[model samples]
Target chain A: MPAAEGTAPLAVILDQAGLDGLLTAIRAKGWRTIGPRVADDAVIYDEIETVADLPMGVGDEQKGGYYRLKARGDQALFGYTSGAQGWKRVLYPPRQKLFSAKRTASGFTIDPMAQPDAPLALIGVRACEMAAINVQAKVFGDKDFADPGYQGRLKGALIVAVECTRAGDTCFCDSMGTGPEVGTGYDIKLVEMVGKAGVTYVATAATDKGAKLLKAAKGKPAAEADLAAAAKAVKAAAKQSRKMETATSAKLKDVPEHARWDQVAARCMTCGNCTMVCPTCFCTTVEDVTDLKGDHAERWRKWDSCFTVDFSYIHGGAIRTEVRSRYRQWITHKLSTWHDQFGQAGCVGCGRCITWCPVGIDITEEVAAIHDSTKGRK
Target chain B: MAERKRPKLAVWKFSSCDGCQLSLLDCEDELLALTEEVRISYFLEATRKIEKGPYDVSLVEGSITTPHDVKAIREVRRQSKALITIGACATAGGIQALRNFKSVKEFIRCVYAHPEYIDTLTTSTAISDHVSVDFELRGCPISKHQLLEVLNAYLNGRKPNVPRHSECIECKANGIVCRMVAAGTPCLGPVTQAGCGSLCTGKDRGCFGCFGPMETPNTAALAAHLKELGCSGRDVQRLFRSYNANAEAFRKESETHG
Candidate 1:
């Protein structure tokens, strides 16, 4: 493949040592490195010391609503689907302190809390995960009311995205247009290549920050053949994905009030696991914790979900008291109404909601039902 | 001496999970600023601060289930200038309204350790069912952005720009490919109201109707499609009788299947 014109070509083919060198270079820069690691029955994102900590030679078995880890025949370093965790855990965080207050002789003196750390490097991020991050950035950073905490944490984080060589059955990034290939908004992108000699990686710098990092690593410049191999890998991943094709935006707006929502609601436990695991879900609730001394009070912000009943309370009563209404609110907001607010789809097509949903309610099937019925409306 | 007037804002709770009230406090940065704009009169969730009403604006959460609640709501109505119901529990009777189908006593016995202690009414009803609601914000937990929009609108004396369209409109505007058409997946985006912005559909999942019915929802047609996709009649009935079971349209649809 020919390089795009006018863009400086910064590419390298790294052997196995290149992986360790990359992690070493990131750590040497005083930036914390977080990636996928094995933990209790599933792969979770955590801090890493070296390349050895990464999930090597492992692929995930994912279905319509199920996900599991399995062994890969080849000892490949980047051969897995997305895990239950996303970068949101580190960037947004599950819980954080907002402010602390104390009563003084004159009045109350409230001290605001500082945001989380900066300059964290996220390695092995997928295309879908990157899309999720962008969606969250809009929610927490771009709007009229920006979340200071999220803004502080995301300021200088470096993203090292990896292109998927294969997709799981549950994968639908292709349908969402988020990915099998790394798109814009990454610092560095990596594509792993397997051959008779050994496992190697073709790395490319997406930004000036990425180019600066690549200058430290010693590797051969990528040949035209290498870039072609990377493109082929991305295409294969896309092909492997199970396609879902409804005019998602149009159907969501057109379908009339339907009983189909009741079908999924009947099995939905409303446990809120889906929202908890979602990468872009930023809704939260606050709690006040008063110190035993009674002079100081602290407030905390924690993640909240629309699936919970208390989320919709009113003076006379709850607006959505039934399971169907709650389910309807969540689905519509994600697929249809999110556009009006954000000018983009709220979902990034990661399929985390499907695999993590305890009852395995599939979103693709629900949209198809609506499309078939609402075609006339369109 | 001249007196400073604070906008009296009352936070009232009925039958809910107490999540929407949490959204107000969830405005950690804005919460302090908000207090300066309005008086924290009757929020039981945040503080023990209780102030007498004739409130400027009242934010009520949860549903009315018992006979006592019916009378309490009337007093709330009388005391507030503008009333807004937040979340699914307040706007649609919430998931607890599942009891709208079966005997309330049986539901109580199924979950409670001491059913006798459960002094509840047979049906869990929404705020609008009993009294006039100025505005209704939809969501199991109303979107904080939408909540702020409602507050800002009322404070400015203007109509809130809440959408009355379906979820399908949001999905199209976002440019997300229809998951159901491409993958044979069933979705509720067509009939459901827009608020969630097609979050589930973008994630490759179907709409579950957490926002409630759209303005002119055609649930029967969507139900027929679900039947074609292998759902049973019981499935159709159960679908409508969910979070908004007590809602007029949803309740009527479920009755048709039943």
Candidate 2:
């Protein structure tokens, strides 16, 4: 076995070359490395085999209905905040086949889908994203009935969390008490410091798997000065301008008739973009498909959003017919009833819901309206 | 207990580019298999061997622009058990319906040297306007995968497994960047139905509303946002007046603008 993480080193320093070799080391050990890469005009999680694939000297400006990549003018890696996509897709894929059936003599023969193979090592995960993953864990696995695909993929995956050094215009993870610092559930926590010495990461292993990988990278022991700078950077990142109040978690369920929902609904396109981009919003519906000849049939589980009118369909018609009800359902369930169902809030303050919304409906601004109004009523 | 027979299928056309009907033929692999599943009783685009109707399932394409088209569609409906209209023409009156906003008589005078010979309706209309359509498949040229699903569902005696959600969901699911939000392109995805596989958006251009209005789409909200994105009155109006222009929600939203 590998040495214990604590016994290995308190922290290690990884320069550019060390970081490049670290990726090779990760892949050499049978881990398919998935990390942030610039694609589709945004930094999204995709297959990454080299450190060069990382968005170096890059930052993003994000706001409600806005995301733009800009040159950071520095070699600092991990300088930007989280993209619209998160690590949720890694664990729970958008579409997965449940099983398939072929026509048999009597009726049909069902064949279950094969379980996932080739374990993944997620790189450059943010603190807010980690919280979202934890929230999903509670939602998917904590119950008596667990999502097999999600549980299987999550159990085998390795997490490489990155501390935020920069906050976007829409980022409010600090307000949610989940971000700007690596809290827990990470194998290796890396903090990047770009200076005259060059881009060096203060990498700390949190598990034996991380330690073994860190040893393979062969990075130098971290200096006290560099460690202090990394800590200061994280603290500065925590001092974000945007903040959201968690007071809605206790009150939003009771006040469904809140007029703010109608106001938000007017601007809300009900496009379902917010829910799709949200890291913790895990809802899927099954699609049963058959070949043209009807000889073969397959069932696939696909991503579903509550914003769709048919989502609440019954025998008679749809329950949430009006736009107001759908928006109300989303916000209320995300903030309040999700706590009732999963023992935690659905949102992780990642601001994806805000950034990706067509009309720029900030969840924090919506919550604040309710939080302030409800608090004033008493 | 009685023996079962294969579902007799038919294909009919009216005023269209025949692209939607061609989508069925584009299913090269599935077409041969489709032939085994249903009798091709009336697809002239494929074969000259004409088979009479009273078809179990009829796939109708194009709009009812002329009086002859109106008469022929009712005859097709009378002869078929389940009538499913395919593409924008048969479902939402196609690009030809742009004349619905203007005078066809004046257009004939402007273009046709012999204006008297041109016999057409003043306004184009969908097949459902005249008769009760069993189902309507909306698209400029309907997706073959979706077409197969519709046929497969109809065969199995189940509701078609098509989603009534917006095109925004399709774009997001496919991991295509939002052209409207990210690039300031005036896409109709938020208000348009989920189909066409985000073709325009995937190409980094805005959706032209080829798939028509989705279920309970907020066109007013999307239109207002489009205006905020620097679209003028005409730009917003023209954005909805594409392949699925004459679709109800789109037509109403277009009327509010230029």
Candidate 3:
């Protein structure tokens, strides 16, 4: 099961001890590595220095509007799916000050805040989030008005994605064709499988840089059985995952006039939580601020939501005034019009919207309702 | 005219706690620079120097719980070119509006040594109830960024960009896991206005509706959902009766459940 003489190693089997070396290798490359950690009763993405810092032996309970971290006995890392925090915050910060101005003797002098330039190595990224990041890259990296900050962050980072061995209750990435397996958009992809022997990570280098790091980390060249196990693990995860109606994404645009919009709107709070948790949701509002003396002023950009009445405001009033209309706008924009605008679906089906929703409003359920109610009518 | 003078900005307080006014002061990073932009004519929380009438923009906090407050707000509104209400107390009737649901005389008798000494209105009403307001920044204590936005908008002759969406939007944007679904906790986030940066939800708890109800909130649906989540009618009632209990939307919702 060794690699052919001239062929490069496609996969490597890393024992439990090699995780430390992997962390060391990432840090040795002068990258600030961050991954999932158990904090505040949930798995949160944070800075990790060692393997122990990872949410080892932790599994998450996720449902529509619910989340909790529990011990799963086996000391398996990357067992949990998406948490409250995503890589988007690390890439495009929640609150970013664009520029600061000062009152000079002549006039005001504006100074753009220096963007953080350090290379970040994001560990434990799920496949769904990879798709989310791709969607975000399209939005923020739009040719016309690309966010320099986002571009810089994207350019300076390395993505270390993790294949899901098990999916969360709210996850529908399988149906979305986004996850449970690692395909692309990552430097390295790790699949941790706990076997009868012990925990071993089936690592695949997606880039040359990732390959060098894997070699430096000193994991054994993966056997054929190890590769099979990893693929089997991903398949099992895909089978176990809660799925959405895949056809709904394509049919979403055609059913805007469906009565289900009203029914879903009744339950939709127009809180925009779904958009907020959505990794691809990049709406932002800018605010101008002046100090007490009015001499120095600064403009800041913070996250905004489509659900806000003022988001679609004009001179007379807001366009989407009704809550139902706003909800309709959000769902349509996310599922249907997003393809028209961004050339891709806005949702990655990570289920953050469902898991973070206060009333447990499920996007997949809403879309399914629309699809089902208007199956052949139109 | 010699040179166009700088517009005067004033911050006024009334019946409630000074938290909202303090929010303006909490803009410590921008406070010194803000003074350079507008004259701080009257802000008792930061400075005691009282400026004369006819201020360009007045930021008023608190509710009209006393007859004195009602008259004072009218005078303040009359004197200011643009009067913007800051916080739940100034827009919605604040936490003290629970008094609106009970007998003022009985409450005065119960809390005070002598009911005769107390001179109070039966209801605590927002400034808008008595006088027209240019804008209202809703929150238990308005966000500093939002307060700055309002002041900036007023100064620039534009509308403030503060949102009227519910807390669920903020919670979602923050990527904070939903406590209601995960823990069976009842959250007011769905119907409550956006602000507070999803603080409660980020801290692993349900939103207590500190920002009040969003415009045209469907409380009936939320109430039914809360019931399905094991929140009884009384629990739903109590949830809506939190910070902005007397705010029209929340008040009606609370009454429906009660």
Candidate 4:
């Protein structure tokens, strides 16, 4: 439950020591707390048991087709940009068994598999990732035939968002109007500031649950100076971000006809890496598995990508036969057609597609190329 | 009238490392259950019991390298209702296709003491190149999961839902960091098919394109990107000429660099 929309939001200040209590509060409510941890030279989201598991004093450098972990002198957890993994994996798993069937004397008896339905409390979620999750909600939470698996995990979930204090080389969430600041869609919004005094966190409660947790944690009301510092950190992040112009997204419909796709196709492996790393990508293919006895069979739904040739397969042949066409479909759908289907852009400007692409093809640059070529062609 | 009979299945091998056939035995948990549904009529690797076919499904492993193998494969196709080729060796000539570039006589002389005793074709080719194939599973060693899916699909009389995408998709779905981006390593995952479960990437190495090129792969684009990553023209050529070198997409890409 959240306070009335017009009411003033409650704010509190917590030092490094108070972070432990915040984790305790979330855990005390019987919620699985997930946060960032250092693994594979990048920040990965996983179950966090204690503060020590967090990637403290760690910063990451991310560019188009580049990522490296850098150690910062000051201990600052949640200091890096979003990594390869996101909250989507927790909600919509990579692979899930839909149901299993056993051969009966007559035909077959099908048994639906039970989905993992534990309540989750996500900590240190970036604003861009929040937008991705929100976008995915529309894809999976459709009224006609919503995905029960995603819905089950989403129910009673808590989001503890963290505003960005720094931006990566590929980041453009500011231009996407999705990040660098946390305005909504969160239970508690935390802004961490590392200063000469010490590392401090400014937290604002947007919901009753968040407010109760903030009150229970050992913390004082945030001073005006502390609030100013938090705002400055976020402002700096926004200023540093290498942004993609959102206006280009409007003209993305003409991208398929552009010659740039062929040029991109030459350098593109059609690897589907970008689609896989994209938090909002929700395409999937079903697989049927049977035991040698043929008595037992199971249907599994695994995460799928549009970059595959089979992804567009029709009765006769593939619809999108060229690698260039597949790339065009992917980028266009993310930027323009998604608006037609979901009423919101598919991309959140988190730049995962740029960072994780095997060849370092930047989506922002592709959009710019399309915009430049399609100019006045209408 | 004959009693309700189980479908007879046969496994055949040609010129390969026997790794793909091992993938069948690797399904240890399902082996017993599988035998109950389909009779293992002619798998020489597993059992001595050989039942002559009119096999319901025939699983072929390895490429057609020798002149004798060419005749053997046609007869096998005649006996099989559905013929499926498994692994790079069967689907795209395997690493042996490297001979397609060089002289077979020179290779035989270099490797064997008696070149006169050796009998091999100048080129190693896919089974489909010689005979009609119902399905082809791609991989250096076809995934066990995929093999099972293919069998299940054929048994149900439906198309197998095998993904024809690059390894980049699997790496991302599994939450793996791109080795090329993070380490400046050149990877062929962009053009290689998805089936190997991102094996090399999981081990912190770039994909070596063991599964060959995905459908309509943009090899020229990937080659140019590889060049930018400091991979020389020869390096790019060698990369494409590995396991599935004779594959149409990879063969064309490698030839461009060569």
DockQ of each: 0.03, 0.67, 0.50, 0.55
lDDT, each prediction = 0.75, 0.86, 0.81, 0.84
DockQ of 3: 0.50
Error of 3 at A108 (Å): 5.4
- Maximum-lDDT candidate: 2
lDDT of 4 at A19: 81
Candidate 4: share of reference interface contacts reproduced: 0.76
What is the alpha-carbon lDDT for the whole of candidate 4? 0.84
For model 2, the stretches where C-alpha displacement exceeds 4 angstroms are A1-9, B1-4
Q: 3 or 4: which has the higher DockQ? A: 4
Residue range A1-378, candidate 4, lDDT tens digits: 247788767789998778889889889989998889987777889889778889998888887777888899888887787866778888788888899999887889888667566699888889898888888888888757788878777767888999998788888888888877865678898998887888889998888889889888879998888778788888877864466756777567855577888888777777787877888988898887765445688889888878777788799977987878888888889988998889888988888888877677898998887777667776
Of 2 and 4, which scores higher on TM-score? Answer: 2
TM-scores of all models?
0.60, 0.97, 0.90, 0.94
Candidate 2, residues B28-76, lDDT tens digits: the string is 9888878877888888999898778789999999999998988899899
Q: Write the residue-wise lDDT of candidate 3 on B79-124 in tens digits.
A: 9999999988988889899999989898888899877888899999
Candidate 1 vs 4: which has more TM-score? 4
Looking at candidate 2 chain B, the ten consecutive residues that score lowest on lDDT are B1-10
Candidate 2 DockQ, CA atoms: 0.67
The alpha-carbon deviation from the true structure for residue A239 of candidate 1, after best TM-score superposition, in angstroms, is 1.8
Q: Report fnat, model 2.
A: 0.70
